[model samples]
Target: MAALSAAEQTVDTEHFSESMHSLSSDAEAFPADSAEQHDFVVDFIEKEVGSDLKSLKNVSNLLKKLTDENNVLEEQVLTVSSSVPPKVSAALSAAEEARCSLEELLKKERLISNMLHQHLQGAQPWMDNLGQILNQVDHIERHMEYLRCLQHIEELSAAVQQCLMTSSVWEAIRAVDSMAALDTGLSQSACSHLQDFLRETLHFWHKIIKDRLTIDFEKVLTQLHWPIISPPTQSLTPTASSPEISSQLELLVTQLLALQTSDDLLSQKDLASGKGGPSAQTVSLATPTSLAPPLCLPIQIMLLPLSKRFRYHFFGNRQTNTPNKPEWYLTQALMWMGNSTTFMEEKIQPILDRAGADISARVELCRGLLSLVQEKVASDASRLLYDDALFSHLVEEVLQFEKELRSNHSYPAALPGLLHLLLEDAVLQKWLTVERKMAVEKMDAMLSAEGAWSSQYKDISDMDELKAPDCAETFMTLLQVITERYRALPCPSAQLKFLGLQRELVDDFRIRLTQVMKEESRCPLGARYCAILNAVNYISTILSDWGDNVFFLQLQQAAVSLGDDVVLRDLGVLELGRLASLEGSLFEGLLALLDRLKGDMLGRLLEWTMREVIEKARPYGQDRWLSLPSQHDLSTMTLSSSACPMMLCVRDRLLHLHQSLSLSLFQLAWQGLADRLNKFLYQDVRRENPQKHCLCFYDLSPTSLNV
Candidate 1:
């Protein structure tokens, strides 16, 4: 068996070697051979190594097992080599895909992180701003609540104080300080309600104050006992006051006396220091103390509460236990006249005197006197003849005083009072009529030569340029006085007489104006003449209404005739175009007259005057007039043995007329003159020259032409 085994081993070895060769030579071609060879190797090993032979059999079993294990390993290797490579490739691909996905996911996460960072970056500022805005809203609401609480408390305190002061519930306000103290604790809602309540309360209080004032004023009026003159006396009446109250009053009086003394000292010091001089630092500082009294007694009287006892004593029914009495105001006036005469005479009269006894002073004095008169008239006592007599005497005395002061120009202050007094009294009106006549005569004489009107005219003539002075303002003042005086008289005859006088005055004025116009026409240039004409026209226009009276109409006609002569002179200059160079003065006169005349009258009069001027100027041809040389040639050229001055006078009269009636009239009259000239040329053998137009006279003989 060993030998056989050896031989088999050699054969097995050879087969194994041959199989190894074939496997090495062609690994792919041996699929059947490889399996068979693997099985054969296993079978040979199992056969050669029988189980009986212990060590050898164990070696053969181990070799055979090792060969079987090798074959299984080979199969596993082949399967692993083929499947594992594909599986490994798929795993590698999947792993690569997963890595790529992870990379993409990381990139997406990075992108999302960047967007979140950007969003957070944008949101941070807004969040911070919102936080700041919310903080401010919390602050404003706190202050509003504080103001509302203060107003409510003020109203409550006022109501409580008002109830405490007077039993009648309508007393003067006493404790405003207490009311103001309550303003701190009030809420907003309470304050609004309190404000409304307080407004209504204030209105109520204001009405009460007014009623009280009226009652006091009425009581003052009732206490005056008119028509009864009495001397001043200081009588001490018993007072119902405790000793302490009396002591307090005494102390108050002492303090008031001290204050008065101090005030007097200060006033004296101020007067001595010349603080009220014209050169003082301020206007108030310059005001004289005498002009404005230190004590305002009238206003103080108005402020005092109504005296109930005085009202009961005076205004009560006469049939009852109450005594009949006069008005308090009259009584007060009497008392003031007696006791405060020094105040009125020393302080008030000095102011009135310094006011220059002018119309304004008179007006103020009249007002004060009238107030006293009203109080006297309102008194319940019987009317006193002495009072009426005293008023009349005062009126007469003031009038006489004014008259005496008139020459000194010191009565202007008194004139207003005089006028008012004249209006107030019928007797004064009658007195004024006689006085006015005397005044009128005196005024007429003064105004005749040295008065404002004549002086003004004389002054105007003395000026470099002769102009009619503006007498309108002075005339207006005269008219105002005359009108007022005429109105004061109740008689229609007197008014008619005044109207007649006014008409006469206006006629005289018109005559003077006409004379002025005529005199002005003698001026070489029409400028001064035209200006005077305009003044005349202005005066004529103002007095035109006077012409409505038949008597005045005749005067106006004469004046108009004189004006016509002036107008004629102005027209002559205008025709020569001399007035055009006169600085528009001639045209100004005509325009003034045209404006003054009513439209219809102006049109008609202007047309008539223009026609007259045109007709008169027709005989003097333009060429003949143009050929006449200026004043320089007057001595050398005696164009005609004619009175040149007379001709000049006529020419000047016509020129004046033309200028006084404005150039507008001439322009209207010359409207168709150009066309008429063209027609005349066409009929009269007029030919147009190349350089200049020429006219050929066909019907002219040498003798007829005087050539």
Candidate 2:
């Protein structure tokens, strides 16, 4: 890259050449094609040097004034030195030294003055004078350069004729271009003659060279033994694998690319031909475009016959009938050519051992050629491989080739262009589309089979057997496969597609699980409660184990609303001072159902024990009422809760019941049941301990107070 920058710097330095002679010496140099560039250069030159005459006049006048002052000082110093006193010999010595110094200064000033005067009076006017004899020399030089350029152009014409006569089309191209670059200052008659010569000579060269190149190309086709296919050739690959195809393509690319480089060098040069020749005061110069590019016309014509075969071999069939670009062949040819040239250099460069012609320029030029074709190949290759299979095969082949290239430690300049053509984002995205569809289908197949949803539940009723879903492992495998596909593609939108697919899968699974939960809720209460708790616990456990994976985080979030798990998880007999903590009446209903179903025998036994306790309370309650401290106490004792003593048996039976049923609902039911027991026991406490001054817990009816 640094070397390329240096080459650019060198080109720019030589472009605005120091002199017309230097410009002519570098005969390849030509002005830019823009007409404005020529005028810009001329204007820049006029601005740089148009004041030379005026500057010379001012310098001459300043020098003359300094000379006159020096002469006057010399005369005054000499007079003072000659009249020096004999008694002060030191003063006389000083005066004589000063005079000699002043005299030396005058001589130097006079020499400078004379030189400037000569430049102004002699050189400047002489250069401008029409009457001067030097004008004849100027005219002679103009006529001589005109004759020289004419001779050079004529020699070029003859060279073209000679090359075509011998069927050397490459040499004909060089000669024709040599004729075109002749920018000799032209009078009307000379220009007319030059134009006529070009019109005739170039046309003849074009006709013969095209024919010659075409013949050469036909031989190339025969040498390769390629199939002669019709227009819009079949898609095939074996022909492109041939090593000889690249070698033959290189031969054609090298000749044309060299010509293109020569034209480019010519175009950047602002000045042309000799400045030693007379100025173009009367004659107008020819436009630089007269010799401009598309300089490889012969080469392009040769490629036309070979293109059908090349397209079939390297590019395959064109799908559309729309005509391919004429220049598109140039890019295809350049790629194969660049690789071939680089390969040849590797083999040949090591063999030379500093013995012969340097291949450095050839190598650099080939490297430069790759950049010119990069954009075209990148665009064309992307369009060619839109099919998933086609794109996949091409990418695999390119990657394998790239791997081999690296293993050999060979870096070809054209490899970047080739690789760029294969690694297109559109191609990657196409693969991602295929991968996503396949992944989703595989996932669907795993779960869409007979009783597929049931299989995922896998003995969830048995806690130890409740492992991850059967499809979980297979789903992960598919996920990984799709993830790798996404990694290979490495696109923003592709990554989004991957994430979205996983999200949908997770969501669908969660929705199915939620549906199962709702369905299970319809079972007998005990069974339904156990089913929901076990299934949700198993799911939570499995999901939690896979919890670190982001996909499972979505599942966990879905499981949040799965149960009253949050309400049931921490409630115990110790914490059940109230039933308000439960989400709704479901807790109360569940407790009653459980007692009816599982605790019925225990309830009947407690009822039998309470009947015996209620029989013992018959008369003790009536005697305790007469022993009351006052009538008010007796009035309060009108009601008796003699059955409250049996509450001890209730507490004991409740303890036994509590031990057997410790669920959230059992604890909740106990809260209301305990309060009712307290209300019955309250009347007994007031009647038995009258000094306690407490009222009866119940407001008994008169008939009901008989106990």
Candidate 3:
């Protein structure tokens, strides 16, 4: 048996080796084909099964297992196959019924499609006819509207003409306005010839009504002798026109206002350009009808006579037209307004009141008069600026006139047009130069004048404080004059320029004060030093007060309109700083001056007092305490008259300073002197004294020291 098993194992090993060689050959020969793999399997089976009976037996058993599984699969297939026939028959029956239903539905769809096609074909001509009817209706409506617009325009034209003939100014203006509205209401396509005719008719009536009202308005004004120019010497009231003239003038003005409609003008322009209709139209110069103030034409008409008179007197080579005397015409303009404005308010204002016009009669008259004044002033200013004297005089007069106009006549705080000519950069620079030169001259004269530092002492009242020197008082007065001159300047840039000039002058004044202080510092007398300290303190207080003043505040606010973080950069003194900052700088500089002056004065006071005390103690220094007193030295035991003189000298100096200096300043000096004297006597005097004589502090009375 062992021999048989070994033989079988040898055979199996040989056969496996052969099968491995064959499979390698098959894989190399046919890597992707199944035929090579099948042949290899057949060769292996034939070799292995034929080589041993046991292999054959294993194969036979496998074959029997496959046969059993095939039979089972066959039975399962038979079971499934038995159910397929009935289900297929049922599906066929259902399909046959669905086909019949689909045929019926298709027949109904064909019939419905034919009916819809027929209906659409039958309605085609009716829809076409309806579209044509709609077009015709639109045309007819537009034509009717056009005809109605033309007819309304004709009616308004006839009504306007009749109203004008009947002197019905208000009715005529309303009729004219209605005609304008109709003309603007029609579109550009509205019958060209008819539109041309209506426009011509409207223009004719518009011109006639306007001309007639203007004529009647002027006639009444002529009767009242309008724009009566009053002389400076004469009173303000003009020759009074009767109530009847005023009533007529009011009616004419009301008619003019009623006829004016900014909306109609703008709409007509839009229609001409084919741009917009009434709803889309916009006014350029004025608001829509009745919302804007009435046009200034009527007031301008009343100003015609005055304009002619002004041109005659100020524009030409007349004796009164000299540039040297700009105030003649400027003042005349103001005077004319003064005379006519009141009359306009009392008489013509009622017309606006009854018509519900939102405007001031006085303002209207003033503006008209100022327009003429502005032109005259500008023309003369351009020529007169070449001559400094004449220009200065002109500026002075203009300032005076502005002051009177605002203070007395209730004009605005500033009027730009009135001062616009003066706002030019070149003009401002020249003006600033002139002002600075004049200011310097004034300052020099003030400082050179006698008693400039004198106190102008008066008996002391409870309310009175130490008086400032004449120089300080006059300097502030000079500042006031400069401030008032530019207070009413209208333009922000111009006001800033003036502010720069003021700051420059302030710096110049500070320099002058410093120089004066230096000159007075060397003097042994304390009066001038006291005066200098008081002046600085006084001027500093004045500047602080000005910082809070409305005038200075307004100047500071005016600089804001330049829309800059910094302004007047060219002016070094005010570069990139506000008026308030410059004010603070000025106050700080004065304070520094005050500190330095106070310190130096105190030192000088200490030195002078100590020198006098030493002089009075010189005799005591000679008579040394080294010698013992005799037995009858009772008089020496009492306080010596020598020490009394030194104490008296110190007391007199303190009293003199108390009377000379201001209270606050005197208190600082006294306190400082006390400290220094105590230190000197304790440290310096004792250290230098070889004999170590006992030092004595005098019991100075408070009443004598004025402490």
Best by lDDT: 3
Lowest lDDT block of 10, candidate 2: 279-288
**lDDT order of candidates, top first:** 3, 2, 1
* Rank list by TM-score: 3, 2, 1
Report per-prediction Cα RMSD to one decimal. 32.7, 33.2, 14.8
lDDT of 3 by residue, 111-228 (tens): 9999999999999999999999999999999889878877887788788778878877678778777766666665455477876777677768877877777788888877765656
- lDDT of each prediction vs. the true structure? 0.41, 0.46, 0.67
TM-score of 2: 0.30
Clashing pairs in 2: 30-266
Model 1, 83-194: lDDT tens digits are 7777888899999999999999999999999999999999999989988887766556545544443444344445644554553222233322233223222323444666
What would the TM-scores of all predictions be? Answer: 0.24, 0.30, 0.63
lDDT (10s digit) by residue, model 2, range 96-175: 99999999999999999999997788777766775566778888998897688678777887887787678676787887
